[model samples]
Target: MDGEYHPKSEATVSVYDHGFLYGDGVFEGIRAYNGTVFRLKEHIRRLYEGIKVTRINLQLTKEQMTNAIVDTLRKNNLTDAYIRVIVSRGRGNLGLDPRSCPKPSVVIMAEPVAPAHGKEAREKGITAIISGYRRDRVDGTSHELKSLN
Candidate 1:
């Protein structure tokens, strides 16, 4: 998706993009309230921290990234919604080398969501969704980094 905005149906990334090819990326789930993004600065700070550790070279400053997210919410005319911000190592070779990627890909998405739970759970129970992603801990020790990869 890069820096430009597009309809979700038309959004895409190259097959060779490291994020797509190897799941090399980081993401944050955010929320908005009444036309204002919640804790946007904190989220941007944390996202940059992850970028620091991952060395993904997002090519956009934290401010730029934050603006993108806010703009996405506005574009969709969404409030009280769940937001997802993703940054990935851009197009690269089929090999495992990070050097192959130069620019990185970025995507921001938002949608209305169900409540976090409580009354809904008491009444209708809950549904669980399983993911194909597998996460492994080092020697059963937890890491501070939460990631999509």
Candidate 2:
């Protein structure tokens, strides 16, 4: 598997990683079109905003993160792809203190994407199911933050 991409064997975080314990992190999903990354700037902007809202300190500049995504796509010889960007609270002890988590974990992954639906579905419209779960109040979770959990 010399040229093949391999998943990380073990993903680890510190005992105090807020993201690991409290789900205090944000993420973004992006898509690339042809050989160009679509809406990349907007995606990064949103990520920055999310970080600011969540108070997660990302070490990399937006430009660096974007370049990393593009580099991965090029390395894999992929044109149409999906990208996942995440910022997590750095490792720390089991305390509810932000100062303990000094450095933040930044991860970017890019991979090819294939949609399941065909043109017929797009033209005819698709059926959707309503979920029983209710969305969190904007005031409580600040709908703007795209963090999981």
Candidate 3:
């Protein structure tokens, strides 16, 4: 069967999915221009790095994942869109145990983005402010890992 053309109902995950359990996962947001996915190599590299750091086992070759992304886009007939690639801890018990979660879930979603005010925003200079909230120190959460807490 052609997985890329399947409906959303056909692409389902178990409720026991560990990503929902322990927030044990990493993801990348990528963009495609024309018909090419940009920075795909970098995105995959970071995903693997996160998996390694989190001790999650994943079996897909990078090429396979890349092809999947492209295939999905092609199936949908979309040339310019955003792609979200996620590798999540697979299904396991209710308890917070990484050992129970042996496999990792890989998902890639592609969709179009509304146009941003590109040059206008840059030329006019967008305004911003530091919110009252302060980000936690990187050391506190091993921010370098780039994985969800």
Best by lDDT: 1
Candidate 2: tens digits of C-alpha lDDT, residues 1-149:
11234464644446566777877788888888778888889888888899988878777788887877787788878888888777878677788788888888766677788755678997898999999898876567664568855
**Scored by CA lDDT, what does every candidate get?**
0.81, 0.75, 0.76
Provide the lowest-lDDT 10-residue window in model 2.
1-10
TM-score each candidate: 0.78, 0.73, 0.75
Full candidate order by lDDT, most accurate first: 1, 3, 2
Model 3 has an lDDT value of 0.76
Report the Cα lDDT for residue 79, model 3: 81
TM-score of 1: 0.78
How good is model 3 by TM-score? Answer: 0.75
Best by TM-score: 1
Residue 125: error of model 2 in Å? Answer: 9.3
Give the Cα error of residue 125 in candidate 1, in Å: 17
lDDT of 1 by residue, 68-90 (tens): 88888888888778998888887
| 129 Cα displacement, candidate 1 (Å) | 20
